[model samples]
Target chain A: MTDQASGSIHSFYVHTLGTPGTESLFWLCATLAVFGLGMRLQIRLGRAPWANPVLFSIILIAAALFVTETPYATYFQSVHIINFLLGPATVALAIPLADSIRLVTKSLPTMTLALLAGSVTSVVSGIALVLLFGGSHEVALSMAPKAVTTPIAIAITSQIGGSPALTAAFAILGGIIAAMIGETTLRRLGITDWRAHGLAAGIAGSGIAAAQVAQRDPVGAAFAALGIGLNGLVTAILVPVILHFLPG
Target chain B: MPEAFFTLLVFQLIGTAAQAALNLPVPGPVIGMFLLAALLIWRKSRASRREAHSPLSPDSEPGTSAASPALAALSRTLIACLGLLFVPAGVGIITELPVLSANALPIAVALFGSTILGLMVTALVMHRATTGGAAPEKLPDTGGQVL
Candidate 1:
């Protein structure tokens, strides 16, 4: 791209969103618009909640990058404090678990088996596709934990020489996409159980779907809660073990 | 804020202990959770003693276990943190824009590919649990729509 043309595009992006809108309540507006668009599309199609929130958000962010003319650095600066909350948000999951520990103890075998399948296949397929498509080892590593919950996914990505930032994107995308398709895929395959449903969604979809499960079927909340932690633990341990065999 | 801060510090210390001492595989949050679970379990086991001095013992059972003020405060603080958790990930992307651009294909491949695969595995596991587990359960009904 020519410098003059690039400069003009940059100028256009800044002018389009209008600088004043990037501050104060505008981000909230943009956030709502982005989520509303995705939700509207989902409802229009009668789709499930997990249908790739990341995809829509990414598209919006990309558009914002150009149309708002605010540099990525500036946006990150504005949002960094909020972003750092991921750490504590994760710890907060402990609440539900502590509340339901006895229930989890009762269903340990089932939950563990479910998580085993989830954590293993998530990483294996992630690595396989990444290689099949000729993705680099770094990319593969970053994606290795996409199926795991966010906090552990970030840790695994960094440990295995993958970019954690990339991992975060992949993890969010994984949760959104999985939450979208989890229910449909279960039925097509003939799997049906509220507990299993919540567990699968929780393990695969993370907190987002888990929350939905709590609303719809409080009984299944226990299993879903266990699933979240199980998948995170299983992935954390297995991803590293598996990474040693991968190219990276 | 200080109450929340102290809760945060306690969790941070517990997380570090679990990770460093026990070689836990998951991150600080998971370790912290384990600690929290342990505490809850201990409190439950010691309900009799705790209630003697405490207000919410079996004898003083308020409708719910309305957690101690500190614990309740901690939960509130954690919920508040959820809104901004994705910021760090966004920051990481911005800081490494050059690298992200240099290898957009690989990143995209890894992301989209894993998502599709992860979705499949997730559903499969759900299926297994439904059929294999003896626990009577309801099949989630959403018409098998792959969103």
Candidate 2:
């Protein structure tokens, strides 16, 4: 298609955003719909990680895309509307952060340092791990930004000559897996203090842990969110340098 | 879920629109939060100054309300978003099942190592800061310190 034609908008009655014969719309809607359905199904059955609402939505959407033979690129394009919402939603989190201004003000310096340390460690080591496992330089670079928020990770991944798409997925997966067994992990380590537990959760779980911490301990959540933000920054700056130290 | 979803949706819309209209660079939630914070800060400053100079006062300190309605509202919002927060993370987990499930053990070790490294660094820095600082005596205790 020509540039002019590509930029033109089209929605033939039941359009797929800009594309045609796309099951993107179906998968997208089903993602939200099946979430409700899954929760109900969960109540009827049980809350298995396999059938958790979020995982369920992913499954439903994945299946839709797979069965309908929809491409990930197409799915991302159609879902860009929701993705755009993510930006605002992230900004809105500042609301809680602001509300806990008193709490934030108290631990400002400590939180920054902690977040910086955690972020730098995660990203640097992630690169080291991939390289150690015999991953290509591109793959190692891609994995380097997996501990930060998606936007930041995507940005850093691109900067480091890695695949943004891969990093985004890895970032989310790392976050979810941390959250899934976060509490159990803490318990096994013999850390029972609420603050420690909550803080650890936020660092590991990213936004999800931050959300959980916001309810009980906004400070910890703030730490986690700050960690997410800083991790992206540090990873973006350090991953390339860190990679240089590794054997080529 | 419906009630929580609706509440978050409305607030998110309000937040997003406010962010867009204001031409803020950050996320809508961050903008909405800043707006909310500005209001609170204004109220706090005005109350503190008034309390400091007032000849007569309703309470010992105007800024100190034991059970303010605003805090309650914020609390409610935080609680409502708890479950919703997991949605994104869970979706992410499913997406990386092949990688995570395949190398669960190594990943677990990494998690522990990183957390320990973080905690030790945090404790040292916090302690050094405390010992070195000579300014305000009543610095805020960061309720949670997760290294």
Candidate 3:
């Protein structure tokens, strides 16, 4: 009886978790379910740095894939719909950015200079540390644009022969870490200006960090939004120029 | 709301097409934003000119003003869930664990060091710029606002 019960339970698990019907639909549902789980955790944790939705969701989804023996390719293929939204979602940023730009028009010059400096700092520092630490050339290249937003980071990474996968990882890592530690660092340093705090976090972390900043204050979000766009623009321009001048 | 959604889609489509045609390195959405900004600027200039022409109507709404329903609604919707859209790309990181694990020490150190350093320097620069070139003065507490 015990043997029979165990066999029945195992089969039931396979039947439910395994790709039983339309594979694409199954995968899509699974991805949504995982993301939803991540979102719940994020809310319950009050969106803490360690409880980041993206990080949590990825962990849950990855574990699910491991347990179900589902191939990464299969999961990716089924969730291309979600991936595709990244394009439109990026465009959506323009709206808030435009609003922010209007509000901060008078401070544009100072903000622009700060962002340019920050952008170059992000690239140079990232690549330098990667090389200093014995990372590969590919990792160095990927690390160069890791401080920017994902879509643009992916573009720059591909352009400069870095792994898009690695770039995404770095981008998310940078964002989460910055979101977690950025504000505290600024406060400790006695940096009270919202613009300074926003630019710093946004440049270091880009999209995810900006999102966290946005949750705190509108003014901070504006600077962060501006930082996200400007950082991407500057990094895109600087990486190639800097690489061209580098001694191989 | 539907109209606002349509406007967003149209702008996004235009942005994508521009990226493809120009072979731009920037993302399509960013280009779309540029186009949107240009359009809004033009609209605002036109609105102000018209207001100037009629000088009687001091209450004319400027183009891209907060009063604009579609822009306001759409932007709010997008901002509300801006964080959600990033989850997929973050999920992509799971597939690259091997490469990450291979360079675990270097990647971790580089990322952590560079991020902290970048944040510090950027904050300092911005602080100097915004505070009349004065260094930041230490404060007992910012009421957690800075965080």
Candidate 4:
């Protein structure tokens, strides 16, 4: 009787795991739990510059799926409710963007010129470097928008015939790299102005580097917010226009 | 809070509609961002105008000049979690692992090299423009110290 009871309990567990609703709930909880742990680990690490929670969560969750022999499509489908919020969250960026307009308008010309230079360099250098290394045209295309925020980068990549998934990974990786080296590099280069530091962080690193800058100074935070919004707009417009003119 | 969320969703819907209608290259949410920004600026200007004309009027509330309190709160919450929103897509990288591994060298080099190059270029350009080609001015409080 005890053996039968144990066998029946095991069957119940298998049945629930196979059910669609339970599967979705299980993945959702697992993703959130892992992300929370990533956040906790970052804090425990004393907020080390390289201890990025998003990067941590992605690796852990990906490993979990891989070990379970789960296809990415099922995992993505299960957690898509979180994914859907990306659209509205992006729209919500306008609040901070609007809040910083007054402060940013003071040096509009300087910011605009810097943004244009940085935006162009980010795209051109990415593609040029990839091709110089014998990377394919498709790979080069994916590299074009690596500096912009992930949401915008994904859209731009899809528009330009690149792999959106590849671009997303590249964009996040670029942000992490920027966050790691941005401050030291800027200081070494003698860029002392907080606004300049913030702009460079925002443009090259997008949101990730900007968050790091924000932790240091409120003034830098405002300018970083400006950098993110304006750079997104500038790159969004510039990439397509550049691609339009280039011979394909 | 619900109302504010609905407001954001409405703006997103409008943006999506515009993108579909125009077949524009830009994404809908981005267009929504621009529109919402314009609306906030307009509201701010109108509020200041009201204050100028009727200083004693009760209609001229201070915090409501731009975004409403609820909307601002909601936006802040969303932006704070913005990093989390990208994780799912980033995880999609697993799907492209073979491609990534195949071209890891170029990908890594280009990502790091271009980011550093872009950072330096932007910083230099902004520093030059702001300082009028003079020596870079140190931050007053920090005294050139970067934290």
Candidate 5:
């Protein structure tokens, strides 16, 4: 009798799994579950600089899709609701940007100079290095905006005819690298000002690197926040103009 | 929260319309960001001016009072989970495995090298500008506290 009941339960499971609209629901749940697990893991790990929840979630979900022989198009369709939220989230960034304006205006001249220098360097150096290494123009274009926050980076990437997916990956990876090396590099260069440290992290690493600085220095975090907003605006305006002059 | 969300969407819609009509290269949401920030800044300044003129009013934090509570809460919640919103796009990397694998070396070099280079350049420029020209003067350590 127990064996018979178990057999019926297994059949029920298979039936539900094979349903039409249920498939999207299943994948959506799976996406959230994986992301939740990743966040838990990140927290459990004490929010290590390299323990990026987004990176973790992407790897697990991508692996699951690959292992299940599911195409990316289908997976994306299932999770499109979450993707739709990105636009509003991007707009929400203005709140913090406005909040920090007073602090930012204090060092306007110096900060503006540093911001311009960092923004130009990030785009030019990434594109130049990619081309120097014989990478394709498409890849170089995607690499161009890897230094800003993910939403802005993705928007800029699409605007510039680059692969948004590749740009997302590059931005996250760049953030991780910057978080890992940023503090030590700043110290080695004999830079001790927290504001400068924050600017460096925010410019090169975006939010992830800035979070690291946030833990140790609140002032730096504020500057880092300013850095993220200002850099996003500057890079968005700068890239197309730069590409317009470049020979195809 | 729902109303706040709708407000954000409205701004984004306006931004999209502006972008298309103006033939701007920047994205719609970014323009929305700028617009929203400008609105908040303007409100804050106006409120501060009113408070300055009125002697009966107690000093209140202008930033908090100017931005609506619901909008502030929504923005905070959204920004906090900002990382999660990008997972879908990042997972699309699965489809570009071929390009990524083929140019793995170059991609790695460009990403890491450029990030480090950008960091160094920004930090040096900021340090130089703040500390004055010639030699770097070690400022008194504020123990990570904002002056």
Candidate 6:
């Protein structure tokens, strides 16, 4: 088929399948359907290290959007409902954190140091790598808090003149990467304690990866929750202060 | 589950309100989480104080008060599917493909290196604090198991 003919045919298909208001339903359904399929695929794959449901779903949905020539905004209109739940989901973290308070309080000092160090390392390492790789200043800034949770990472990205959207991508990317490699790496180093594992995942991975860690141990989840909250709080304060000292 | 969901939504509402009122940089849900944790802790303390005089039993944990069940259920449901909640935003990454692609090498290197380094450093420091800098004599096959 000729390029123009294929383009016209594609447009016709989309027009026939999706109308203005109805597109929201399609996109919402598409998002969930793809996500469900991804979940099933992960389960079928026996939850292999590389077969993460979130990453799988994102790839499937993004491909669907591209094929249909659908704008991201159209898809996001309905998907945002799922996005809105992130806040409540974050609040849910307090449940695990509270449940493990005794453990959290017992090693407050170590946890505090780990959180602070992890937060700073995430910001500095991201920015430094961006610069070293010849990325622009905004890219560096956007990536600065990539290790933190999405909402806070977005907030910090905007505060420091970076793109919030990019920050969200970076946050998700970091979370997936951390969730994928965090436990295995720790084990490679002979780190066995769930507390250390959870704290590391929480600080390095933020809430998403922390949730992954939460599946292992409630005590770990509690610390992961603490790591998320404390890392965000620390990064929020530290990013601006550190930027003030840096050249850019 | 529905009641538990609503209870969490209420806590989230208070958190969002707190964020707006205080102009805090931290996300509202995070603040709300702290608030919820505090309330649960206080409730447990009160329950514990009352339980102090009663005959001690193995089943009587401080935090397992009657008021806790609903929130516990809510938290479990939310956390279990936490990965699903993040999909919309993760899908948004496609919108930035141009930027991601252009800087793909650097972004990839940075994300990969920094995440690995961050995990190692944080884990090491935590291990130091937790175990007094003692290294385990033999490595265990962590298998990256959840628990």
DockQ of each: 0.33, 0.17, 0.48, 0.50, 0.49, 0.54
Report how closely model 6 matches the true complex, as a DockQ value.
Answer: 0.54
Superior candidate under DockQ, 2 versus 5:
5
Error of 5 at B131 (Å): 5.2
In terms of docking quality, model 3 is acceptable
lDDT of 4 by residue, A102-205 (tens): 65676788888999999999999998899888888999999999898776788888988999888887887888788778877887777767788778988998
On TM-score, the candidate that comes out on top is 6
The weakest ten consecutive residues by lDDT in model 5 chain A span: A9-18
* TM-score of candidate 6 chain B vs. the reference: 0.81
Q: Give the TM-score of candidate 2.
A: 0.63
Using DockQ as the measure, the top candidate is 6
The predicted structure with the larger TM-score, 2 or 4, is: 4
For each candidate in turn, give its C-alpha RMSD to the true structure in angstroms. Answer: 6.0, 9.2, 4.7, 5.3, 5.6, 3.6
- Candidate no. 3 TM-score: 0.83
What pairs collide in candidate 5? none
Q: What DockQ does candidate 1 score? A: 0.33
Those runs of model 2 whose alpha carbons end farther than 4 Å from true positions after fitting are A1-29, A37-52, A77-79, A190-202, A212-220, B1-43, B51-147
Write model 1 residue lDDT over B53-122, tens digit each, in one string: 8665456342233245666556545543232344334324444567667767766666555555554566
Ranked candidates, highest TM-score first: 6, 3, 4, 5, 1, 2
lDDT of each: 0.61, 0.52, 0.74, 0.78, 0.79, 0.80
Instruction: Order candidates by lDDT, high to low.
Output: 6, 5, 4, 3, 1, 2
Q: State the lDDT of candidate 4 residue by residue for B1-147, as single tens digits.
A: 999899889888999899899986556776787788779888877877777777576664433426888998887677665667767776887888899999988998899999999999998998888778545434434434643
Docking class of 6: medium
Off by over 4 Å in 4: A1-18, A150-161, A187-198, A207-233, A236-248, B54-65, B133-147
For A134-210, candidate 5 gives per-residue lDDT tens digits of 99999999999999988789889998899988898788778878877787788877887887988888899886677
Compose the digit string of candidate 3's lDDT tens values, residues A1-248.
36676566546546864554656677677767766676677678765555666666677777666655567777777678777766665555555555555546756777787887888788888998889899999999999999998878988999999998899899998888887788778778988777777788778898777776665655676678678777888888999998888666
Listed per model in order, the count of residue pairs whose N, CA or C atoms clash below 3 Å is 8, 9, 0, 0, 0, 2
